[model samples]
Target: MVRNVESSVDDVYEWLLKKGVSQKISQIFRELLAEHGLKQHISDATHRLGHTLDVLITREDSSILKGIPFVADPGICDNNGNRSGDPLAIRTLLRLSKAPRERRTVIFRKIHDINIDNFRKDLDFSSVTYKEASVEKLIIHYNRVLTATIDVHAPLKSKEIVIRPNTPWFTDDLYSAKRDRRKAERLMRRTNLAVHKDIFNQKCMQVTKLIQHCKSQFYINKIQEIGSDSKQLFKLTNNLMGNTNLSVLLEHDSEIDLASKFGEFFIGKIQKIRENLCSLTKSPTREVVLRADIKFDGIPLEAFEPMSIAEVCDIIGDAPTKSCKLDPIPTNVLKQCSESILPIITEIINKSFSEASVPLDFKKAIVRPLIKRQGLDKDEFKNYRPVSNLPFLSKVLEKAVASRLEKYLNDYQLHDNVQSAYRSSHSTETALLRLHHDITS
Candidate 1:
């Protein structure tokens, strides 16, 4: 075994030519490898006899494989310390492509950083201040103005944030305690003082107790939040037991295809329901009059009155600060600028009522499909339900409509007297009381 010959990139081209490859083809191959940032590591002979028989290739810029693969003596060790000259041993250490500190990008606007006074001033002078004849146009203008003003003040910014596995019980207080414990341990190690040792011991006990307390409280709160939902409770228990939450993977090539399949499944279910309804037998029946001499005393509700700015402001103020991604602005931001935008919103609501139509933006909703419960066949679309989230303005408008409709119903005595559900001051308890009174009477 002796090192006598060295092989280079040129030697590879020569070999390719010896194998009947044309000069042009060899040149193209070399160029392709170079373009892909490939590197050849085995320049020295690997065989026992001095010939470069093996090639080690890797990405030139990748940290996944560093340095060259170690070329052990071309032989296998036998039981009696004998070497068999057949295969060579190649060794390398493999590493992950990304480091632990790898960061991800997140786009968000600092809504809390916005100045309310400046925001109000900007909205007052914005294009939304001018009234549009059509409700749709007015809504579009309002959305544009609000979005632009908020963007100007808050601005959509991107931040590279590192994401790592986290425990639900790990709170800021617990983190602080751990940090103090480590500092105390370091002081004890450096000073070798009895007080420092005692402090470290105390810190260790404090951290241990905090960890147990935090973990127990976390589970307790989670169980309470889950309440009587057996599915959630079982899922939590499984998670605590280190069982995977992943369901059976559906057959699809890509995410888009998977989403399409889900859509098809839900649509097919709806179609099947419609088909069943259509197949049902229909019978024509005569209507029986309960009171032949009864007169029509209720007034017909055709249109709603335009709400005042004060009323719109009150409604907006009382509304919960919940928002959907489809909303033009955050609910809190909208509330902060309500004074400047109240007239525009009030006008839009009145125009919508007059036209008997809602803005198209308000009609659009974001739909999310969630598994109905754990321990169910998630691969089956039947086990999933669609939850739709409407924008903030949509909910506000609906509240206004509901209030007006309720007033109309109350004024005309249109509601059923015995109905207890979905009515103010009436619930299951009231329904039970009514049943008791009827039984006693």
Candidate 2:
């Protein structure tokens, strides 16, 4: 039950006395509370436990109140201090229609055109020991070109560039007023002077009003600038004040803590599995020959076919944008210049197949933990499941590989008719039908 903010412990005892409760029982209750070291709070300049209670009581609907009282900012309750991180200057890079800096894709196209000429002069593909190595070098060069393009990220977001949140409306005047309020508060608390208290209250009101007016004007301007575009407005709003914090908990609420925990879970388990595999006795392996039961003239039997400029352009045009990518230049950026870079991509793809190897960089994935159950303590790592977000380029390359392999397998009828999963035109329904037929027969 929420005790009234104005009521003291003596008032509670007196109220119980009037209610015909025994004095001995009421005294015992007070004694037990003191023995447990539990405390009721009064609001002060340094802490606001009672203020939080007042807000909750005033804001919450009476109809919804149930069970025990719950409070978010129950201040000075325990010695283990709860901390909200020092405020972060979240990036407000609002537009995707235009690059904030010189576009990396354009620079990459220019550099590759230059590099291909220089490469052709000194380095012949035929003379190159490994075509795979050459292709790898080309990709590395592409990354280098992208790296040289200007940094488009917001400067305040960078920790090294230590500018505080510089919202157009939050000015030096407001900051000075806020500082003065804090000074007045400290003076009033120490001296208990009515004059200092009045000064503090005045400063507080001034800061709050100034902040509200400035912020209201700023947001009004942004909305007007965005006009009637609902999607852009929503995106802008989300970027400005969205809950970007991941729900998962790490020991110190640090990225380093998360990484270390994941490393222990994944890498440690993999190492253990490897040790177990090594301990197992060797099993004889056999080479299974693939025979053609069905033939398709369009599908290549011996070698992978090179995708034409038109084919590459079509594929990239249908590519999903705003997806995750490890590379600085995203697939969306690449799609814009797909036609221009087709020759270079075709060369790389053809060489890649001829060499029959891909760089290990393509295997990289970002693991994000998703909460599996809501009520479980977030600090308990097992309650969450990890999801791997593959780079867009890697996914595209993987699809190309899968397409070639599936084509070859389908042409040769390499998989048995019994196979119902991991194939087109086969599903649980088909598997069930086949099972039913066999069972009856």
Q: How far does residue 255 in candidate 2 sit from its true spot (Å)?
A: 2.8
Quote the positional error of residue 43 for candidate 1 in Å: 37
Residue lDDT tens for model 1, 177-226: 99999999999999999999999999999999999999999999999999
Model 1 weakest 10-residue run by lDDT: 1-10
Cα lDDT of all candidates, in order? Answer: 0.80, 0.60
Clashing pairs in 2: none
Cα RMSDs of all predictions?
12.0, 16.2
Best by TM-score: 1
Instruction: Name the candidate that leads on lDDT.
Output: 1
Q: Where does model 1 exceed 4 Å of error? A: 1-103, 124-132, 164-177, 180-203, 213-253, 264-295
How well is each residue in 1-441 modelled by candidate 2, as lDDT tens digits?
235433445455566787898899879866765676545432221123222212222223233333433333323233466553222111212223532443222112332233333333332223223344566776665455444431321111212233344577777878888888899899999999899889889988988898998888888999999999999898878867963445656567687876888768877667888987766534346333566666655645667776565655565566677556476455654565454455555566556666677756666778877778767787776676778887665666666667678877888677788999989899999999999999999
* Backbone clashes (count) for model 1: 0
